[model samples]
Target: MFYFSVSMREVAFIKQNKEKWLNFEKTIYNNQFKNPDELSSLYIHLMNDLAYAQTYYPKSKTISYLNQLASAAFQRIYRTKREKTNRFISFWKTEVPLIVYQFRRYVLYSFLIFGLFVTIGAVSAAYDDSFVRLILGDGYVNTTLENIEKGDPVAIYKSGSNWGSFIGITLNNLYVGLLSFIYGVFGGFGTGYILMHNGIMVGAFQYFFHDQGVLWESVRGIWIHGAMEIFAIVIEGAAGLLLGASILFPKTYSRMASFKMGLKNGIKILISTFPFTFAAGFLEGFVTRYSNIMPNWLSVGIILITLSMISFYYLIYPHIVHRKLKTHVSTL
Candidate 1:
C-alpha cells in the first residue's frame, strides 16, 4: 500500500510486482538469510527505497513509510547473516584476526586472574597442608595421593568409555566455560575468582605431588592432557574478561549495547574453543589415566605432541590467518 503513491506508473509497477516482491521477502524471512545473494538483493532494494523516498516524496507519508520499510528490511537482513565478509578465506583473513586482536587483552586479564588466585592458594596452603584438600575435595586429593604412593599419580583421570566420556565431558566442560564467560558481569572479579580457583587447584595439586617425590611423573602424566585442558581454561578466562570489559567500558555504545557485543564475541570465541576442549577432555579422560600403562617416554611424547598441537592451533594459526588476510586486503 505505501509503495503505491508516487504516480500511476509507480503504483501500477508496485501492483504488478507486489506478489513477486512479497514472495522474495518471504523466502528471505524463512531462510534467515543463509544465502548471500538474497541479502544482496534486500540491500539493493533498501537503497533504492531510501533514494526514492528522498527524491520524489521527501515530505510525504509514503516517503516516511518507505523509509520505515527500508530500515526494517535492512535490520532483518543483517541480523541473521551479520557476516561482514563473504568466503572462508575472508573469514580466516578478517574475522579470525579480529578475534585474536580482541583476545590479546583477554590474555593479560587471564594472567592477572591466575596470579591473584595463586597468591591466595599459596597463602592458604602455607598455613595448612590440608588446604589443598579443602580447595580440591578431600576425595580427589586422597585418591591422587594414593596414586602417588602407588607410583601412578595421574591414574584418577582414566576411567569411562571413550565415546561417552568424550561427549559428556566435552559438553559439561563447555557449559562451565560458558558460565565463566557469562559471570563476568558481576564486576568480572567473580569470573577471575573462578579462574584463580582453577589455578590454585593446579598449584596445590602439583605441589602435593611434588611433596610426594613424583613431580616429574605428575608433570609427564598430568600435562599430557593439562597442556590443552589448561589452555582451554585460560581461553575461557579471556572470554570472561571480554564480557567484563564490555560492562566496564561502554565506549561508543550504551552499556547494554557494549555488553551485548562483548557477549557475542565472547560466545563465538567460546564456541571456537570447543574442538580444543573436546580433544583435551578426551585426553584427560582416556590418556592421562593410562599414563602408567604406557612407557614413561611414550607418555612424555604424548605430552609434547598435545602441547605442540595446542600452541599451533590457538596461537600460531590465528597469526597465520591474520597475516594471510592482510595480504589479501593489500591486493584488493
Candidate 2:
C-alpha cells in the first residue's frame, strides 16, 4: 500500500501541488538564464522516470502525479526546442560548410555542368583551324603569330604593369562574371547564351595561341587564374539556376517560400565567390602577366598551389565539418 496505493490524503496533496507546479513552470520559462539544452535533457530524464513510476503505481495518486508531470515536462521541452531551433538558424554562418557538404548533390551537379562546357570547348578547339582567327581578332592572332615566329608565343605577358593592370582587370572580370550570374534568372535561356559566348571565346583563344606553335605557353599563361575564376563563374551560374529553378519547380512549400529560401542560399554562395574570383584576377593580372619574364617553373608552381588551396578550403574542409556534424547528431 505504501509502495503503490493512492490514499485520500495523497490525492488531496497532489491537487494542491499541481497549482504550485504550474507556477513553477512559468517561473522557469521566464528565467533569463534558462539553457534550452539543459532543460531538454533534464526533462527527458524526468519523463523516463515518470514512465517507470506510472507503471509501478498505476491506479494510485503516484500515477496521477507522474502523468501530470510528464505532460507539463513535454510542453517545456517543446518550448525549449523551438527557441533553440530559432537560435540555430540565427547563427547559420557557422554551419555553411556542413550545409554545403550535406547538399553535395548540388556540388556534383555544378561540376558536371561545368565539365560539359569544358569538353565542348576542347572538342571545338581540336576540330577548327580558321575558327581561331574568326573568334580571336586577326590583329591579336597576327601579333601572337609573330611572337611565336620569334620563339616566344607568350611575349605579350611580360609587358603589363602590376598594380595598375590588376586593379583594372580584376574589376572588369568580376563585372562580367556577375553579369553572367545575375542575367540567368531573366528567361532561363539567357545564361546559356552567356556560357556559349564564354566557351567560344576560350576555345578560340586557346586554338589561336596554339596555332602560333606554343600551346604550352597559352596553357601556362591562361590557366593560372582561369582555373579559379572560370570555376567561380560557373558555380555562380549554378547558384542563379538554383534560385530560378526553385520558383519554377517548388514541390512542397508554396512557391514564394521556396524561392525565398533559394534566393537566400544562392546569394550567400554568389557573395562568397567574389573574393576567390578577385584573387584569381589579381593573380592573372599581376602574376601571369609577368610570366614571360618570370621562370616558367614559378608560374607552374603557383598554379598548383592555388588549385590545392581551393580544393582544401571548399571541398575538404566542408566534408570534414559535415562528418563531425553527423557524429554529433548520432551521439545526441
Candidate whose lDDT is highest: 1
lDDT of 2 by residue, 110-148 (tens): 556656665676567678766666766688778878878
Report the lDDT tens digits of candidate 1 across residue range 231-319.
77778888888889889966434688678867877776776677778888888776776777789789888888888886766667766
Cα-based TM-score, every candidate: 0.68, 0.67
Estimate candidate 1's alpha-carbon lDDT, on a 0 to 1 scale.
0.68
Q: Which segments of candidate 1 are over 4 A away from where they belong?
A: 1-94, 119-123
- Where's the lowest-lDDT run of ten residues in candidate 1? 323-332
Clash list (residue pairs), candidate 2: none
Clashes of each: 0, 0
